[model samples]
Target: MSRRTFSVVVLDSLLSLATKLQSGPMPEPRVRTAGATRGRLWRILMVAGVLAALGGAALVVTVLIRTPEGSAGRPETAAGLPGPPIPPAGTDAVEPSAVPTTRPVPTLTLPSSVATSASSRPPTTSPSAGRGSSTPESAVVPLTARYTTSSVTAGLLGYHLDVTITNPAPRAHTDWRLVVTLPRSTLSVSGVSGATATQDGAAWTFTPDDTTSRVAPRASVTVSFNVNGATLLNAAPTDCQIDNTPCTT
Candidate 1:
C-alpha cells in the first residue's frame, strides 16, 4: 500500500484501541473490588504492549521499503523516499557531451584558369641533356667577311684593304681562318695585323691569333693589309672564305 494509506490505517487502529480502553464494558460488580482492579490494570498494560509492538514493526517496514538496496546509510533526499544516484567526478563516468576529435580537412579549390595553367605547363629538362660535341642542326655557323679598300695616301701602296669578319652564330667560334684569293698580278702585301698570314699562289690565308682566336656570338674581327700593286678601284678579294664556308664580298 502507499505510505500515506498505510500510515492512516495504523493510526486508525491505535485510535480505536484507545477509545475501547477509555470506555470499556462496565465490569461486573463483584465482592472483591481489589481483584477486579488488578485484572483491569493488567488488561490495560497488555493492550499498551501490543500497540507498542505494532508501532515498532510498522517503523521497521517503512524504513526497509524506503531505503534502496546496497545503500548503507548514505545521505538521503526526502522526495517522499530516497534513491536517485549522481555520478561522481572521475574518468570512469560517461561523458554527457564531447567534441569529435577527427574530421576531414577542408579542401581548397583553385580557379579554373589557375588549374589549367598549372596542368598545361611543360616540365623542365636539363640543358646538357641530349647534347654533346656535335652542334645541333639549328646552330650552324654563319661566318662572313666584308672587304673594303681605301686608296693609300702614300704612292708606295696601291690599296689599304680591311677584312672585317662577322660571327652570327649563337656561340663563340674557338678556331677560325680567312682565306683571300687576291687579284692576279697583285704586288707583295704588307701591314697585316690581327692574324698570322700565309700565301699560296694568289691566295692569302689569315689564321687568327690568340687575341682574335675566339669570335664571340654576333661579334666581328678585322684584319687589314696593304697591297702595293695595280687593282680595280672597287676590287674585292676573290675565293674569300672563313673556315670552309665561302664568304662572298
Candidate 2:
C-alpha cells in the first residue's frame, strides 16, 4: 500500500473509534419512548383524578354538615340540596293540640253582712190589724175623744149645731158610741150623719152607722142636730161621753 492511503485509512479508523466512543450505546426505539411517555401521562391523570375525587368528597361532607346546622332534621330536596330552615313555633302560633284550653270561671261576690242583714228585716204585722167588738178583749187600748162645734146656722126653730167626734187612739175602734146630755126642752133631734141618734129626755145616745163603724186611729166623725127653742142661742152642750168614758169639749 502507499503511505498516504495508509494514513487515510488509519485516520478513518480513528474517526470511527471517536464516533463509537461518543455514541456509547444504541438509542431506544421510538415505540418504546412513546409507550413510556404514555405511561407517565396516565399516572399523572390518575393522581389528578384521585385529588379531584377527594375534593368532591370533602365538599359533599361540608355541605351535609352545614345543611344540618342551618336546617336541623329537615328533609333534603330532590336536587340533593338542603331545604330552608323551619322557625320555632311562636306563642301566638301554637297549635290547639300543643296547649290545653280552659273555660272561664265565673266569680260571685256577696256583701260581708248579707246573712245578718237579711235576718234583721222588719217583723211582719199581725193578720188582724184592727180591734173589733167581737175580738177577744185584751187590755183596753189607750184612747181619747173630743167634741167640737163644727158649724152653727139659724133655722126656723132656733139654730142647728154640727158636732164632730174625734178619736186620738193609735189603734182603730170597730164599734163606737157617743152619749150627750143637753136640755131636752131647748134641743130637738134631727138627721145625723154617719150615726144613729136616739133621745130620751136630756140624754142622747149616738151609735155608729155602717160607714162610721170603724174609727181610724186619727180620724173624726160628725153629727148634726137642730134646736127647737131659742134658749140654745147662748147655751152650750152640757156633757159628752164616749164608750162610758168622759170626753173633752
Candidate 3:
C-alpha cells in the first residue's frame, strides 16, 4: 500500500480497538466499576503500545525497500536534490580562472635639449613649370641630375661632361631629355654623346638615343657630351636639367 494508505490503516485499527474496549464495559456499583474500569484502561494502553510498535516497524521496512542500495547515508540539498560531490580528504581544491591584466603603453625617449613641433614642408617643384610633362604632379618622378667634367682638350678647350640622370622611382622611365645652357661667349659647340643632340640658340637639348632610351628603376645613367669653347679654367655649365630636374655640380 502507499505510505498514506498504510498510515491510515494503522490509525483505523487503533481507533477500532479503542471503540471495542469502551463498548464492552457498562455501569456498575462505584467500587466494582472502579476496578473493572482500571483493568479495561490498562488493556487498552497495552494494545495501543503493541500496535504503535508494529506500525513503526512497517514504516521502516517500506523506506529501506524504496531507497537505493548505497544512497542511504548521502546528504540531500534543501530542495531534496543531490548536491555536487565534495573532494576527498587530502585532495587539492580547484583554482579559479585567471583575469587578464592590461599592458601599459610604451615610453618614447627623445633628446631633451631639442623642442619638437609640426612645421610645413617647403613645396617641391612640379614638372610642368620646368619644361616637363603635363602629367599630374603626383605621377611625376622626382628625378635629379648632376654633372662633372670628365675631360678637357688643350687647344679647343673642349669639355666632356658626364651628366648623371638619377631615376628615383622603382620602374623604368623612357623618352628622357637633358637640356643644357652654355655661356653665350662660347666659340664653337661640339657634338653630344650617349643621347641625340639638338640646339635652340644657346640652349643644347639632348634626347635619349636608342641605347640610352630607358632609365632603369632606382638607377643612375651617365650621358656624356662634348662641348667646345669651354675653357679649362672656367668651364661652368648653366641651367643643366634632365626631365626638368635641375643638375647639381
lDDT of 2 by residue, 1-249 (tens): 545433345445555654564467534334655777776676567556655655665566566555554465465576777776666777344344655578789988668699678778888867575655543445456345666553344333555556566666556777777888875544766756778888878788888888878777678777666545554355456877777788776
Candidate 3 Cα misplacement greater than 4 A, ranges: 1-138, 152-156, 185-187, 230-234
Per-residue C-alpha lDDT of model 1 across residues 203-237, encoded as one tens digit per residue: 88898898888889889999888876665452446
TM-score of each: 0.41, 0.39, 0.42
Q: Please tell me which predicted candidate would have the highest lDDT against the true structure.
A: 1
Ranking by lDDT: 1, 3, 2
lDDT of 2: 0.64
Q: Whole-model Cα lDDT per candidate?
A: 0.74, 0.64, 0.71
Q: What is the number of backbone collisions in each predicted candidate, taken in the order shown?
A: 0, 0, 0
Residue 14 alpha-carbon offset, candidate 2, angstroms: 99
lDDT (10s digit) by residue, model 3, range 3-118: 55454566566667656655675444345556877876776676677677667766765675576447665556667777787889999989788886978889887654443332
Residue 197 alpha-carbon offset, candidate 2, angstroms: 0.7
> Which residue runs does candidate 1 get wrong by more than 4 Å?
1-138, 153-156, 232-236
Which of 2 and 3 is ahead in TM-score?
3
Task: Give per-model CA RMSD.
Answer: 13.2, 21.7, 20.5
Task: Give the least accurate 10-residue stretch of model 2, judged by summed lDDT.
Answer: 148-157
